[model samples]
Target: MCRSGTAMRLTALTLLALLLTACGAGGGQDAQKGGRKPVFPVQVLEVQGGTVEYAISSTGSVEAFEQVLVTARVRGVIEKVNFREGQEVNPGDILVEIEPQRYRNELEAAQARLDKADASLKDAQAGLKRREDANRQTPGIFSPDEVESWRNRVNSAKADVSQATADVKIAQLNLRDAFATAPMAGIIQSRSVQSGAYVQPGALIATLLRRDPLLLRFTVDEDEARSLKQGQQATFTVTDVDQPLKAVLTHIAASASSRSRMVEVIAEVAPEDRERVRPGTFARIRIVTGSRDNAPAIPQTAVRPTERGFVAFVVENGQARMRLLTLGLRTEDGRVEVREGVKPGEKLVVRGAEALKDGVAVKIDEPVQPQDK
Candidate 1:
């Protein structure tokens, strides 16, 4: 009975040993598999060489190329308002008419005075001629002083005639100015005086604005302003309009502003686009300063900012490889120029890149596709 009991105990111990060994093997296998590096699911894009435009973006307001304050040049009662508010006018188009009756009478009076003065001048010259003839025919009949006096009288009459002629011209000018005409081709923004409103010289009549080929006034940083040149191509969009408007950079401030430290710039819109945008409308301007040809560019989303300038992940041999990028100008779109550390046709990890490290295994979640320009 003792021997049988010992045999049963040894058999149970052997069975327990085998169970422990199997458990140890299974745990070791699990640990070994768990220690292997993980493969990350990712999406990537292939780099391409394309034309990239370097641009400076800014905000600005629309302005009229020419704005003028129409003022009355003569004192009179406004008789007629020929143009309504907001009416387009051409050069020499009559805008307002003042009562000309009083000015007409003044002109007539001036002309009569001139005529009288002319007759007096003629009479004075005739007398001087008669005196000189008498003096020449009979020596010592008229003294030198007397002849001189006649000559002086003729000079005085001539001066009076000249003054009268000048007065007549002044009166004519006043009469003509009584009818105010447009000095330029523009739109009347506002009319301050109505018919029968009395106005004096320099009185506000209306405001005129040249709308065609409007000016877009914007400001830029000092560096960008320095790079800008006359006739540079640009574009802008307003909140109200879907279509972008094109313009040409025309002027740059010689010095920067004190408050904003930015230089002001002016861009001229095309005539066809002028009516679509109004003065004082806010605009977002993008000035195309230059272009890059055959530049390898990547999506902005693929670039990750690092303690060092920037880094991007590119897939090589099914592994995430890190690259330090020397970035160049960023295009208006989100594409950034890769100046160094990348090449065309390289697959850049756009998705699942943030969690990747150098030499991490990568399982491409989506096939590489051509980047839409």
Candidate 2:
């Protein structure tokens, strides 16, 4: 009985030991599976060196190179308005015509008066010659006083002829002024006269504006104005227009405004772009104030705002590392200039930067593509 009892005790002890060992093994497997690290998918881009232009952006209005207010030069009833509203006209193009019948009659009357005066002067001269001949033929028959009087009459008739000639010329000039012509080549902006309307001298007729090689008027701050020079190349983009127009800097104001501390600038658009752009259009100008030939640049999206300053994420040794950067000018195409804390040929994580931090291991799914310079 004692031996059987001892065997039962030994068997029970062996079963308990086996059960404990199995439990320990199961705990070890669970720990091994739970200790696996989580991985995150990330994207990256490369840092590059290229030329970067620093520009000052500004808004401005478009203006014509020339603007003129057309006015009537003579008073008359408007017979016809030759030009329609907003019509393009060349220099010397007839825009308005006043009733010329009255002027013509005046001119004819003046001519008639001139003819009569000329006839009277001829008659007076003939009479003076006759008197002089009589005095010569019959000595003491015709007095010297009578001959002198005839000469005086001829001189008076000559003066009348001269006055009539002057009047005729004045009348002809008035007739020509009855029609108003365009002073310059431009488009009619507004019309103030109509057909059959009575117009007076110096009355408003129309307004004309020249658009070819249009002028863009913009204002810049004092600091920006100081950086600009005449004849510099500039580019302008019209509001809601896709393409940018190239222009040349024409004028820069020497004085600055007291209230705004800004100087005015004028840029001339190319002649070919006149059809696409018009006067009084709003546009934005990008002037290349300065440039660095070899500056490091990165995609603007890669930059992240941090408590300290601007920062970027970089992949180094297959791990994410935070790099603080000093930023420079931003380009029009959404790229930023990097002055410090980055090197050329270094890989930068442009895509997945928002989810990354320092010392995080990452598996690069694809190689980073090189950015364009």
Candidate 3:
């Protein structure tokens, strides 16, 4: 029995040794594999070259190229109103006509007076000639004093004829002015006189606005306004208009507003677009200052606003690198032009960049991305 007991103790010791050996091997493997460092999952985009337009956008309203108040110049009853409130009229188009009878009578009366004065002058000249002929035929038949008196009469008659001629011209002008005409080609904004209404000189007849070269008046930042040229091309989009329009910058204010720090600018609508848009229509304008092709650009979401300016994250060799970017104009398509710092072909962290620290490990989430433009 003592020998069997000793054999059982030896078997138990061998079993314990095998178990310890297995445990030791497993612990060694665990120590060698030491756990992986945490990696931040991020979305990255490849920077690509794109066409970037440097443009400034602003809001404004359309304005008439010229506004004028049409007024009557002669006193008479309004014979006719030839246009509606919004009808377009051309230069020399009659807008209102006064009674022709009264103006015609005045002109005729002035002409009759001129004829009478001319007849008197002719009679005086004939009498003077007779007196001179008698003096020549018979010496001292008529005294020199008599001849001088006749000459004076002729001079006075000549003055009367001259005065009457001026009166006739004045009357003729009044007859012509009886018909009120448009001085320029324009749209009638309002009409104040109607048919059969008695109107005096200088009475309001209508309001006319010139149609050609419609102006787009808008306010822009002073910095942007200062660089604008007189003939710079502009694009316009008006409310309810499906197609965009065009204009040319025509006028810029010499000074900026003190309160708003903005400059007033006027752009002339393109000839083809003038008829499409009207004065007082609200519009948005875009002025392209420059353009760059093959410029490095990235998604706008990749950037973070910083106090100094802006910053973005670039992933290089499995780590995030913070870069200060000199950004250019931001496009409507959600991309920002990188003027400096970042370059094309670099990996830009977009989706999860906000949570990443500089030089931290990042695992790029690869997904099918649409083309960036």
Candidate 4:
């Protein structure tokens, strides 16, 4: 009975095995028909070599090209202020007027003294001529000592006249100085003294700023500063301004700042853009440090930063391949220069790279052309 039971169990197991084999064969056939790996859709660009301009960004303030402090040249009561605050003035434009009565009176007094001295000089010359005539006509009639005395008197009168004439010139100059004039063309920044106020010589009257060509002052780190050169182009934008100001680097400090260890740089704003900006306005400046020509470049979206280095995806043989790159300059636009590990004319996956893995199959749309550098 035990032998018969064992034989039945083996027959049941054999039938179950046959049913499993048939199901496995059917599953294998289905997989063979419909098991193709997915092809990821992606956007790509043909990598091209072009010029890349590297920039260093820094913040700075706009300053006037030149600043002048207008001062009072003579002491008097301020009679009239000819200019309002922030008025545009030209060279020789009268800005302030001091009370001219005092200066006028002084000039008149000097003129009168000069006239008196002139008359005295004439009298002295006439006297000396008369004495000489008398001595020549009558020999020994006038003593030598007496002739010498006449000559000395004439010389004294001439000296007095000369002194009075110099005083008159000084008085004339003082009167002219009573009216303060602009020494240069600029915009008045402030008005320190008002009409009817007393002012002394050398007292601050107003501040003037030359705004036709503004100056932009900024600082760079030690490495960037060392590489800076005069005549490099820079562009800056200020708050609330739609347009940017173009400038050229004109000056670089010989030594770095003691406190910050950064070097100072100066740039002159383009003449056409100066009036649009004002001094002390904060600006963000991008200075062109260097440029690369015909360098392999890719769009910024294609590159991803990782712990080891930067990684990019390139399409090769209808599959995505990962590339490690040594990067150089990033241009003003969105292109990044690849220093190593990439070549021109290669297909770069600019978009749809987030989901891509190395060696994955990809279905690319129409390849994009690279933009002008």
Candidate 5:
């Protein structure tokens, strides 16, 4: 009876083994048909060699090409203020009119004195001619001494006439000085006087400034200024401006500042874009101190800041690969120059790289062309 019971248990155990083997084979088939390795979706950018600009960032201000302080040349009461503060003016435009009555009176008086001097000279000449004629008609009628005295009177009268003529010219000039005119075309930066105000000669009245072809004033460290050159391009932006504007380096200080060790730089804005910014406007400037042709650069977004420095993800054979980067200058736009690591023509994962590991399965879209550097 014991042997029969043992045989039944053995058969039952064999059937259980067959059923387990069949179930395992079916599960393997299901995995082959329906299950696959997980893949991370990502965007890819193919690196290409291009000119990469290295910019030095700094804060700066816009300034007028030329600035002048308008001052009164003649002292008088301000009779009429022809210009308003911040008004636009042209060359020879009337700015202010001082009281002209006194100058006019002076001019008229001078002219009358000149006319009297001319009449006296004419009388002196007539008397001299008559006396000379008497000497010719009768040698003794007028003595030589008397004739010489008449001649002296004429000469003195002539000197008086010359002095009176000079006085008339001076009075005329004073009359013209009573009216102040613009020396050049510009906007009035300030105004200091109004009607009925008395001003002395050389008193500050207004300030004028030329706005177009504006100057961009900035400074750089002495060490970095070595790469700066005349006519090199730079870009700057101000509050409320949507896009960066251009300027050209026009002036570079011959030496560094004694106090700060900073080198002053000046850039001129293009005439066509002058209206977009104003003098004294605060601006952020990017000066292209240096450049490298055919350099590899990547979009700033593609870089991952690690504890060591920075890392970027690249795609290779459907896998994500992280690369340690030795970076160079970052451009004004969101691009970074790669001094080492990652060669041109490599596929860099620009987006969807945050979740990447050094070697992880990834499904990438076709590589995109990087923007021109």
Candidate 6:
């Protein structure tokens, strides 16, 4: 009886030992599975505030402020063209000269007539003086009717002299008109009439463009137009030009076009840069609507679209924290303005943001480098 009791006790102790070991193994497995750590490879950036300019880009053409179509003012055969094709000219520079022989002959005839009229006026004055003296010497002997006739003849001779003087002035003006001169300083873009081509009054001879202080015209959409104002500064780039040209906003249309729903804007280029640009060239305009000082911004690549809103991953205490951000304007490059949800001097995960989640542990294998301008 004593041996059997001992055996039963030993068996119970062995079973209890086995049960304790199984419980310990189950606890170990739970710990290994539940306490697993998340590992993330990320790139980080320091966020800071600075001046940020928001710009709108549009394509437009370069234009001239003053474009003139040169035309003949008088009808005649073109004798000589003083200006060559694509020549630059100043105001009052003679561009073309018509045949002046006809006008010269008319002027000579007018001068001869004027000379004859002057001689006739001298004779008429002498006659009037003689008639007045006769009237004074013999008031009753000289008939009043005869004196009146002499007065009328003197008046008629004076009228003839006045008419001839007017003719002479008209002839001189015609001779001056034979030479066509430029009305403004500009470059000759095209020439339509040759040296020997017969041209009438108002015939197109050439086209001139005022290139100095050139004008640039562009249209902006309704949303963009709302941000623009007069007297703003803008920069533009043209094809084949290495650097951008600067200009000032001169005008903003008060009303938008009904059909296109766009507003027209005009910018004036500086005179010094006019030689490098030409009219009708395509250009790209960047207009700055507003600017922010000391604002937090991040590379556009760092931002990712999420279900809630735009989000960016930030590395804090070696863990990834997803932040909801409010965005502002985008810069010319790939950077975007962060209005809220991020502070300056905080590191942002730029490269590995896509593969990250909230509370994930991150290991920054490489540092992020800024892009070149």
Worst 10 residues of 1 by lDDT: 364-373
Give the per-residue lDDT of model 5 (tens digit) for 1-373: 9999999999999999999999999999998989876789988998877899777888999999899888888889999989987788998898988878888999999999999999999999999999999878887798889889989999999999999999999999888888888888999999989899999999988899988669999999987899889998889999978999999999999999999999999999977668888899998998776679999989988899999789999888989998999999887678889999899999989978988898889988665665632
lDDT of 3 by residue, 1-373 (tens): 9999999999999999999999999999998798777699988777889789999999999999899999989888999889998899999998888987788899999999999999999999999999999988997898999899989989999999999999999999998898899999999999898899998899999999997879999999889987798999999999878998999998889999999999999999999988898899999999999999999878787889888779998889999999999998899788889999799888888788767888899998883264632
Kindly list the per-residue Cα lDDT of model 1 for residues 1-373, writing each as its tens digit.
9999999999999999999999999999999988977899998888889888888999999998789898898998999999988799998898888888889999999999999999999998998899899988998888889889889989999999999999999999999899888889999998899998999999998899988669999999999998899988899999999999999988999999999899999999977888888898999999887888889988888899999879999999999999999999886667789999799988888888879999999999866575542
Kindly list the per-residue Cα lDDT of model 6 for residues 1-373, writing each as its tens digit.
9999999999999999999999999999999988958787877778878999888999898998888998887788999888877799999998888878888999999999999988887887888788789778877566778778778877888898899999999989878878888889999988888988898989998899888779999999988988888788889999978999988889889999999998899999866677778899999999887789999979988889888999998888989999999999888778999999899999888886777889989998677766621
TM-score of each: 0.84, 0.72, 0.82, 0.75, 0.69, 0.79
Segments in model 3 whose C-alpha atoms lie over 4 Å from true places: 1-36, 219-222, 252-264, 306-309, 365-373
Model 1, runs deviating above 4 Å = 1-30, 33-35, 139-155, 367-373
Task: Estimate every model's Cα lDDT from 0 to 1.
Answer: 0.90, 0.87, 0.90, 0.89, 0.89, 0.87
Model 2, TM vs. native: 0.72
Worst 10 residues of 5 by lDDT: 364-373
Ranking by TM-score: 1, 3, 6, 4, 2, 5
Give the count of colliding residue pairs in each prediction.
0, 0, 0, 0, 0, 0
Backbone clashes in model 5: 0
RMSD (Cα, Å) for all candidates, in order, is: 3.9, 6.9, 6.2, 5.3, 8.1, 6.4
> How does candidate 4 fare on TM-score?
0.75
Model 5 residue pairs with clashes: none
In candidate 2, which residue ranges exceed 4 Å CA deviation?
Answer: 1-42, 112-169, 239-242, 304-309, 351-373
Score residue 334 of candidate 2 by CA lDDT: 83
Query: In angstroms, how far off is 1's CA in candidate 1?
Result: 12
